[model samples]
Target: MRLSNLIPSIPANVVACLEVQGIRTDTDLLFSTTTFDIYKRLPAGTATLEELTEYTTIAAEIGAAPGMSGHELLLLENTYGDVQLRTGNAELDGLLRGLDGRWIIELSGDKGSGKSTVALNLLINHLASNLEDTALWIDTTCDFSPERATQFLDATQTLPSTLERLQVSLAFDIDTIQGILETLSRPNDPRARPRFLVIDTITPLLGPLLSAVSAQGHAIMTDFMRQLQTFAQASGTAVFVINNSSRKGRDTPERKPALGPSFALLTDTTLWLEAKNDNNTEDSTEDNTVHTMQILKSRSAPIGGCCTFRIHGNVICPT
Candidate 1:
């Protein structure tokens, strides 16, 4: 049903603004992010907060009517539902429980810990399994190596076009990421919805905002996380964020995610990586280096599970 159908109930100007945002049908309004977010994007006088909330509520009810799955309602054919992503290494998959479901996961560690390698492995393996599926990589720190990704795809022996299905974007700030999330939230978007989403090294984007004197930083961080969660839940996109580790205190050995506890609490799981051998050694090759992945927290698996793996060429081998 078109937004114009509800014109008498909803303000005409409000519908016009929503249409400007590409919300033409009831499903579009229903799947778009929260009412407050939409309100903020609209012209100042277009819609009040209460008005948007009410309008969205109406859209939701209509969209949720009996016998209508979200995919059916939105006319989004062939959309992927909850899925278990694998890295093709049996031991690692067993350790991660196949990295199942649509949830937010964090992969964090010091440099050379093999976080990006493992993440890229996941993306390659998932895309290779089904050429029709797509994934997203948000390169916040400009660390996404296209050459490395190509090498991984070549190792899998999949067609060259498999790499084409992985959508990559360089977004170094909160606003850019927010815009990306909003675009993914739109039901009418032209690009295929990604089954997996990665934000590599979130530290650079969020690290500077966290300060001793400002609560606003925390609020902004929280909002960004919430928006990510909203997108994950709404779209069934398995989200992975690459994070960096930091010392818990001034002089202690205890380590925590650099984004702190607030960010940790928002994610469904967290995995910490550590390089057992220095891959930087002139004598060491990728085959000889070992990395350990430790699950610090999880909702689907045990909290202390650990797996050891090595990067040989572009493939992850369980050691």
Candidate 2:
């Protein structure tokens, strides 16, 4: 459980800082501290978000930490006030407790699995519910539609004002995505920061790079994830990243999410959405398609928890 042995590639400065703080082993980090606690112990301005994230990732991988007890976790939640952005779906909300601002939420699915629809619903819901709060939507796939946003708000009659608060940015490449994230990291006005951030299908934007040259792609993705972690932590902004799923063969047990373990490990929650066949029953007549969302991995909730829902009009509701 030595920190150096567990993550050999850990930055030298981070290792030195950990040693100086007497945190030579994984248990030293786990028993009496949180990642932030460790970060505070590091030399001022020497620890980067990426380094701390890598440390925690190794901790999880090596099972050095058993996680916080219920009491401690509950105390933390109480301090944070349990504030979250609602998904506009009651059942989904009940399962997820809403999109939490303290962690990243990753949604992975194949094309036509209602990922974008759900993201848009959350954006519209947040803008409608909180008039002063705004949202930033980074569309990499060019699938975001203003018309759909307007349609979602038509029922609530808050389209005009909600649209004003919803900021849209198109990032066609990795550089653009990185630049946008950087801009968010250093907001001109703290009050103008968005309540939540969305990147629809981050895989599509980074997939080609990984396919062409994996090492360079992984480096870029790692930096992107680090920037995202920093931005979310600093701003307390709820981040929702949509990803594509790798197709599975008939013999494969299940489909896997793209971007490999590094990206997967970066997220706090990973939800996999798969389209279900039409049952053709009385309830089935209400919607065109039903989606089964599996809680593949979660740090706060029980893993393997799942729910079924359908997209009716523009809103996602449990079936």
Candidate 3:
């Protein structure tokens, strides 16, 4: 019964999740058929039968041992009120807290700016912080693949509970898109019960919702946003709406970002993603690619301040 036997057959991820619940050591695990199935699949014997028995017995004992601890719960006191903003970036984490009630974190930039990577990184971190809260991610396009998510988890060192908290609605229809969010916002829905929502690339959903012209588009936009805002406020949930920038034409550097003015008004914060070329093609010192991000509109903090980040596989790192 060597510890090494538990290596492959059992997904490190399963054990990892339990570890976050303060069940770090193997002795803390609650033994059950699920545990046996997982470990049995590993090499013949990782830990001796005696060791496994002891671990399970302790797990059951700990389970019966409790009143709740206050820290594990999320801050839902603001449920259905104003949206609050917090930066996942440790650097700005302190600077940004409770900035606004309705926030929009827009990730934009040329290709490979690590825009999606950053979004996933923040989410993983958020999940690790609130393991009990259930969260939903609506991917209008198939962009939000689980494989990609796993990569990000490893990179950010996100806990298993955080990863499990997420329930993704993949490749949804144009019409059925917002319904995913609306339904989750419903009081009884388990996923939305935690008040966390993420609509990756909301444009696809907007396609069906937008009306004929300028005025109509504006009306639909506002009403739609209002629903999101109201639901977010009432529920104490943190929503991350990720979007891409358009290729309207790069006339001016200042006008690089492409977002409708009306749409911008509804958000409490916006982050613009951009790429900083470091390849030898232009200035060949290091054959590396660097993506830069900027706080386009904080509505509460410094503007134009840029931060460089990297998405190596699923991990987003400070470049």
Candidate 4:
């Protein structure tokens, strides 16, 4: 909290000037008075009003959450790495090297590929493991089904009260989802904070923004994605965003994530889901289909790790 901690950001002379005014810590710089007042109190030309404003902004950010050193970050990973959140399927969890901590995991696939099924499975498994833990599901397509979630919860033997911890919000626009993220990023009771957040098909919310005539939409999309990363890091919550796939290029049958290349870099990992066969084969039951979830991108784990599973009676089962 020492004013020197913001060195290089707040110039040495500026820090000295502020220190002369008894504004030593970030809290003092922020709470002593408005940024303009601080500028007025400073010796003429010691620092510009614009410069003073920028310094205070940086101070506020540091106060909210300071940067993590490399060693500290390594320790954090080691601590949370052992407690990966299950995808509700053992094989799938092992295949992806286990998901943990504050990172974005994207699920992208075509319609009928069972993206929602996988998301619900993950949410139920997380909520069932602990009674006090909470999760948020932002439904963008109005396709989130409580009946399907009920099936998953039942399979996990999640207590009836666990359902209370899984809160779902219908968000069809970027603003609504952004507001939700901002709200979650604020300080709250540790037990009340959500440990996992799912945006069921982010495609609906971001697709138009990326396809607009003006280039401003792209900027908006970038800002929103960064906001997501900030929220994840601030709260140590694992974010899962679902996306729909599109053809890799205009003249190709191969498919890729729909949000384009920028979005790919924004997420920590991307999982592509494909349904090999959805129809009931002669050997299969009425409600069963073999699906493969493949890792498209990862920082720590190797890419292209594909795991197979099936939806039997709405429950995801490892093959």
Poorest 10 consecutive residues by lDDT, candidate 3: 1-10
What's the lDDT of the predicted structure labeled candidate 2? 0.73
Error of 2 at 203 (Å): 1.0
Compose the digit string of candidate 2's lDDT tens values, residues 95-143: 7863466578898988877788887887788767777777899988788
> In model 1, where do residues sit more than 4 Å from their true spots?
1-79, 188-191, 278-283, 286-288
What lDDT is reached at residue 35 by model 2?
81
Give residue 163's error in model 2 in angstroms: 1.2
Model 3, span 32-138: residue lDDT tens: 24555544544444555565555555445432323324442333342344433333555444334534443545565655666666666656665676555666777
Q: Of the pair 3 and 4, which is ahead by TM-score?
A: 4
For this target, which candidate reaches the highest TM-score against the unseen true structure?
Answer: 1
Q: Give RMSD to native, each candidate.
A: 7.2, 11.1, 18.1, 8.9
In TM-score terms, candidate 4 sits at 0.74
Against the true structure, candidate 3 reaches a TM-score of: 0.62
**TM-scores of all candidate predictions against the true structure:** 0.75, 0.69, 0.62, 0.74
Could you tally the backbone clashes for each prediction? Answer: 0, 0, 13, 0
| Residue 173, model 2: Cα distance from true site in angstroms | 1.3
Q: Write the per-residue lDDT of candidate 1 for residues 1-319, one digit (tens) a residue.
A: 4566666777788888888887765756766576677788888888778878888888665544235466663664355556576887788888989458779999989887888888888888888887777899999878788888877767777788888888899998987887787666655443357888999978899989998898878877877888788788766688999999899899898777788888888899999999875667875585557788899998878899998877887568645
After TM-score superposition, the amount by which residue 43's alpha carbon in candidate 1 deviates from its true location, in angstroms, is 16
